[model samples]
Target: MNAPPDIATEAADHVRIVLVGTQHPGNIGSAARALKTMGLRRLVLVAPQKFPHADADAMAAGADDVLASALRVDTLAEAVADCRLVLGCTARSRRVQLRELRPRDAAAMAHAEAVAGGEVALVFGRERTGLDNAELQLCHAAVHIPANPDYSSLNLAAAVQVLSYELRLALLGAGGEMPVHAAALPAGAVPHAALEGFFAQLADTLEAIDFHKGRAPASAMRKLRRLFVRTGLDEKEIRLLRGILADAQRMARLARDAGRA
Candidate 1:
């Protein structure tokens, strides 16, 4: 009968997003801004078209922190790894039997799951086509925004705003302590610049190995960056990954030296 709260009931009630195959950087940026407005800090990007763009940051404006702290992964499987309940967004009803909810109902369900100490997630598909069967199977439920059936093509960011607004309402209503900005993050989160450098190095390595399924190197780099951005990696995780990268580089150098001999 009543609306959902605006902010998280507790820190654990975080309303995280998993954007799968997003094609636009601006949409990602706008979505980040929307999440920030609703006080939801966690984001998980999965195989986006482009990321770590000046455009995304520029669009985020005051929500730059969200852009800086996003978590990215190449696959939806990895993005939802920690989530106990994954809800995918759909614009159309399906012929197959599946659990689906309107945006309000989905928000209410996700909030209850969060309060129960469950790791919940909301998954969004590409701007053009929604999730394929492979992607949807990963979700326990699907959410459909109740728009006019005559015109159902909602822009990706608009859909994000709709869901985020409902969550903000729900969290603000349930009543909770003030936000914990400083202590909430895992200790020693990676700074933005360092992560950018890591992306460059990672891109170089991936290019050498041709790991992007025939996508051009430039396009691959963009996708990889989106994936990394959503991980929300801390300093320790970054350092560990960088060390791995360094080792690979070292091995390649040794091979080159021996070949030169």
Candidate 2:
């Protein structure tokens, strides 16, 4: 059993580049380039003003892979559900009492947290409004790209690049293996076996109540696979969950025996 993505052991790969409600096409393009320069590939755009080969592609330069692989979603919740850790990139101070730091400091903190346990994510909001309080609440902390506090608003892509660059440096300088904060991450993605087992049990339970109809098990399982992958769970958390499920089965058996006796 491995540990889950906790406040620690989560690193750069776990970091996700999210653009919430972006307005300009060029910003999107530049952001993609920023991510590529930093060795980050995960990009999520929540209801951008425009996509599908905007001027962003031109700005992306040779790093179009970031744009090509961009995950476009209808909502912010959809973008971060499976993420183990969430961070907001903000220029202004947060109203609520959440941790906030300059970009360099925030990057270092996020990097340190990743070194400890699970995957981490740094989210950037739209161009004008930035991350609203509601959006910021989803984050464990807020990251600020230090600028002239007199005028510290950075473009969305610039923010992305700054943080990404920090993470890249942290990863390269990382000596040997990152300290194992949790059970070994379940080898990149969740094992098919685990997902299959969950599906089998879920399908059986659904059938017991006669719910499932035409949903293909394998196809249906794809959604679950994405769900698990998004969370970036380490082996330990998965085992704990399985253990709880197994105990429920054991209890059911005991109840059945008692009823018969």
Q: Write model 2 residue lDDT over 1-261, tens digit each, in one string.
A: 223433222355667788998899888889888887776777889899889755888888888887888989987667776555667888665354455565555555556555654456678888888887657655655676767767776777777888887666555554233434322222223333443455456545444433447655544444454455446555576677667666666666676688799
lDDT comparing candidate 2 with the true structure:
0.65
RMSD of each: 11.9, 11.0
Summing lDDT over every window of 10 consecutive residues in candidate 1, give the lowest-scoring window. 180-189
List, residue by residue over 192-235, the lDDT tens digit for candidate 1.
34555687788766654446668766555544554554355666
Please report, in order, the local distance difference test score of every candidate based on alpha carbons. 0.70, 0.65
TM-score of 2: 0.61
Model 2: weakest 10-residue lDDT segment is 181-190
Report the number of clashing residue pairs per model: 26, 19
